[model samples]
Target: MRPLTEEETRIFFEKLVKYIGENIKILIDRPDGPYCFRLNKERVFYVSEEIMKKAGNVARENLVSLGTCMGKFTKSKKFRLHVTALDYLAPYAQGKMWLKPSAEQQFLYGHNVMKSGLGRISESVDRYQGVILYSMNDLPLGFGTAAKSTSDCRHSDPGTIVCFHQSDIGEYIRSEDTLT
Candidate 1:
């Protein structure tokens, strides 16, 4: 792990901020030594310190975080809401996709939602971008990667529209101590 210089943090943040919007209250808690980007100091993203520092300039950078980790730290690490970083910019979020009740079940089960499953979405969203998946009631379900462009996701026939959820509120109790 390394630390992010002020410059690396700026570039990394600029790209993501566009998806979220300039108004979202994101702060770099500590870009160096275990990178932490926080939304209002509550929801936090823990990505690698090195990756944050090394990138001179990268666009549409995947907001990968601790949840994306797949090793021993998986259990100990908390699920970070990389997508919800744009929640504050909900009004301006271009990559939002809402699902029907049936689709919500599949999404929570770690299945990709096909285009038909999408009940609503924003048109400005691009392909392979981070998107927020919402329940029928408009409650944020979690975040995912767009499998197709927003236009394609809307009318591109039956196919995966959103990637498997990367992080959700449910993850708080998962891979760790549970009510059980």
Candidate 2:
């Protein structure tokens, strides 16, 4: 992968910080390796439609791709955050454990956003869609935090414990007898 331009780096950092603050999770199923993020949603909803839009712009302007495949390949592409509570806490305070995203990954991310918009216009059926928050349960870890994931192995990754389906109400629901 090529080096990220200054702006790409800046946007990447912003995204990382925002997700971390919002407890938003990011999942990437890449050829190299699958990754997941458990973010902190303590202060506020850092990511907004506007931010997503900007991210879209950044991808187009910089020629970055968010994911390997764009919405063109699929219909009604969904964008959602899957939440899960950990029996053991994340390694934030532990330090070093937190990983920085590479330039290619960030580029691919920007592409995902752009594809969402194109998806709306590209298909007559509006097949390319947006993110879908699934299976959210319980409050954020800290007073102002949320959580997200990046799953690849599938087995090792935790399934949805919480979700952001209702952005306005911040609704969280339990799955069967899982959380109790």
Candidate 3:
């Protein structure tokens, strides 16, 4: 697949926001890492297939509290998750993050701590702020990163407010020049 044009990425995000709702919480993985989430209603939802598929809308609305924004579910038009306004859980501690396009980028690795027993061992969607599509011939120097022992660390794309742990390279189509 070829790299997505800026318009294409924007359209994709618009569709996601429409389908998932603005206030909905989203957890997702990066191209090659763990997971992260966005419980804050004001934050832009980061959609990665790896994390979204794992959780698959296990949580919803008020009770939904927290769950991974698996890309498998959100990236696809077929995913129909329960859409309801989110009431941020004080205990979980939520906030909104932002993102934009740039030449350089970074990724982090970590897991969600919103569930019982699991303690959010599995990565979720809070990580990603957004995507930065570059010309097919200009890929970011280190768009990808690795986890330190996989103990759940917060990864942030300094350029963009978006952050994620796991890497979801499959989500984006790469071309020879795009990342070069």
- Sorting all predicted structures by lDDT, with the top scorer first, yields 1, 3, 2
Candidate 1: misplaced stretches above 4 Å?
A: 1-4, 11-15, 25-92, 177-180
Between candidates 1 and 3, name the one with more favorable lDDT.
Answer: 1
- Across 65-105, the per-residue lDDT of candidate 1 in tens digits comes to 33122111123333333333434434445578888887887
For each candidate in turn, the TM-score is 0.56, 0.19, 0.18
lDDT (Cα, tens digit) per residue for candidate 3, span 29-86: 2345544433222222333445445435455333222342222223433322111112
lDDT scores in order = 0.55, 0.23, 0.27
1-180, model 2: which lDDT tens digit per residue? 122345443443443343332332332233434432211111111223334344444533353332221111012322222222221113221111111122122222221112111111111111211222111222122111122222211222233221122121112233322211
Who wins the lDDT comparison? Answer: 1
Query: What is the alpha-carbon lDDT for the whole of candidate 2?
Result: 0.23
| Higher-lDDT candidate of 2 and 3 | 3
- Model 1 / residue 94 / CA error / Å: 3.3
Candidate 1 lDDT score at position 98: 89
Model 3 C-alpha lDDT versus the unseen true structure = 0.27
